[model samples]
Target: MIAAKNVSLQYPDGTVALKNINLSVKPGELVYITGPSGSGKTSLLKLLMAMEFPTTGTLEIMGRSYGKGQTGPIRQLRRMLGPVFQDFKLIKGRTALENIMLGMRFLDIPASEMKKNATEALARVGLKKKANTPVENLSWGECQRISIARVLARKPLLILADEPTGNLDRENALNILELLVGCKDEQTAVLITTHATHLIPANQNRIIRLKEGVMEEAEA
Candidate 1:
């Protein structure tokens, strides 16, 4: 559902964060992008999310060219994507349910349905009891799960998570990974960038490695 061809990214200060990276992700597939810090893994995710445009080459999401034409198509394409950023960008004043409802605000979904979806999503991440709690009151792990629930509420076709387990303990990390992988069942594709090699799912064959802005197939 996502493809990048010869994509390159350069910062204003002449830093080359990515170099001729080419990658493809199919529907219902779960892939991992593993690399050390400054390896361009997050850069690549930013490009996919349209948060940053590639300096060179093309990026296509669900067959729509990302860097071309009107922003309507880009926004529409984003509607099908759910991103869990490294920082867990939750609104500080909003409750967990409110945060998740924000994902459906643009879709014209009914209020009742939105509530139901958000509750279900939070329950999926084992945070149903904290649905009405404000984000500021949550612990680090709880906040992270709430962030994932916010994305999951949208039922996005593609999930782009950057360092999804960076702050959690091993058990929580495993639970989050299982939740992500379990969502990849015929309609969704998941791409995660992480530094924890041992956390990588053993049954999955799709793994891509990045090193100093270079991309390559990772060995099993």
Candidate 2:
């Protein structure tokens, strides 16, 4: 569902973050991106999410080409992605259910269906009892699950998880990774970026290893 040909991203200071990143992700695929610090991992995700335009080359995501500075279209394009960002960007004052429903408020769906989806997502994430609890009152892992619930409720075409397992015990990290990869299906593509390479099951083949802004497929 994504194709990047000779894509490179350079910052304003002329520092090259990514160089000639050629990647193709198809539907029902679960891809993992592993690299050390400042290895252009996040840069690639930024390009896919349309947070930054490529300094050189072209990127097409879900059939939408991201031309330079197409803010309006990029904003609209994000609706097709269910992103589980690192910060767990949940609204603090709102309950888990509220935060989940609010993510889909702009999609023009009925409020009742939105609420139903939010509750179902929460239950799926093993947080049904905490649906009414405020986000600020939840634990770190709980908050992370709520963030995931927000994405699960939307059921987007693509799932982009940026460092979903940053700080946690090994069990927690594996649990989080399992949820992300399991979410993949015939229509949804799951692309995850993580430094905990050991958490990725050894059987996975769609792994892209990056170093010094260059990417290559690592042996499974």
Candidate 3:
């Protein structure tokens, strides 16, 4: 779960990236943050990821406060999170399975269990057959699914996907979104940031909008 109260982020250059943003996300919830370029969508996620500290207000991710002097805790907190970066971030020459396993190397899991997790994750993404293929040889959407598999292998408590559908066609984008939504369960919360509002399904109600550093809840 995440809780933010009056959070604001300002860069050293006097640029305000977010303004008085207050939000609460609970377990099993899938929330979508939508905004245009230069909006505060990514800024808000950076704050959650502890990549940037808020200039004002408070933030609590899974009951841990994030700010100055919390480096160690922040590092530990990151281990519980799965972040799907805008860039696929896969090593070019590595096989898809290897890429997923590489992500788990830092964890305390055993090698056998790690491989099991990685294989299962690949299956979840419908890429089990391509597990041995080098990521460089995979299609763009396949690479994206592989990225998601890497995150799923970690069994994270929270999933933060930033623009996971940015590079795909409409059908692929929708499929990617559905795949991400399927990852949500009783023990996991999902937060996705994207600019393509039209791609969002009509059944999704937990939506937030940002513009010029401002935050507003979408009308139900």
Candidate 4:
């Protein structure tokens, strides 16, 4: 779950990345953030991930207040989030399974259980067949899924996907969206950001659009 009220972000350069943003995300909910480039899609995500603090107003994520000077708690909160960054930060030399498992090594899961979850995450993303393939050799789409599998293997309570369908074709893009939606449950919430509004599934109902740092509620 996430909550933001009259939130605004202004950098030292005096550029306001977001303005008067108000949002609330609940468990079991799937929300979409659609916007053009430089429209503050990434800035909103940064607020959620605690990468940037609000220049004004209040914000909270997963019940943790994301106020300035809370870096310690924010760092701990990150461990519970499944973030699929726009950039596929895959380890080039590692196998798909290994890359997925690497994200869980510091968690409480046992080694054997970790592998099981990694394998299961890969399968859920339709990449089980490529589990042993080196990440460097996989296609862009495959690498994207691998990045997703890595985050999913963590069993995060909140899933934040930034442009999960960036470079994929229609089929793959929809497949990725389906996988993301299916990952949510009663105790889990999902928030996805993408510039391709057309790729959003027809069933989606909650959408927020941003332009020039201004926020608006759009019918999905």
lDDT of each candidate versus the true structure = 0.88, 0.88, 0.92, 0.89
Model 2 segments beyond 4 Å from truth?
A: 218-220
Cand. 1 TM to true fold: 0.95
lDDT of 2: 0.88
The list of candidate 1 runs beyond 4 A from truth reads: 68-70, 218-220
Compared with the true structure, what per-residue lDDT tens digits does model 1 show for residues 91-149? 99999999999889997678789999999999999999998899999988888888899
lDDT of 4 by residue, 14-87 (tens): 99999999898889888999999999999999888898999998898887686667778887788898999888
Q: Over 4 Å off in model 3, which ranges? A: 218-220
TM for every model, in the order presented, reads: 0.95, 0.96, 0.95, 0.95
Per-residue lDDT tens digits for candidate 3, residues 70-147, read 788888888889989888899988999999999889888898899999999999999999999999999999999999
Number of the candidate with higher lDDT, 1 or 2: 2
Clashes of each: 0, 0, 0, 0
lDDT tens digits, residue span 1-220, model 2: 9999999999999999999988889999999999998998888898899888888888899886877678788878898899898899999889999999999999867887999999999988899999999999998888888898899999888999999989878887888888888789999999999888989998886899988789866443
Positional deviation of residue 150's Cα in model 3 after best superposition, in angstroms: 0.7
- Candidates ranked by lDDT: 3, 4, 2, 1
How good is model 4 by TM-score? 0.95
Cα lDDT for residue 194, model 4?
Answer: 93
**How far does residue 15 in candidate 1 sit from its true spot (Å)?**
0.7
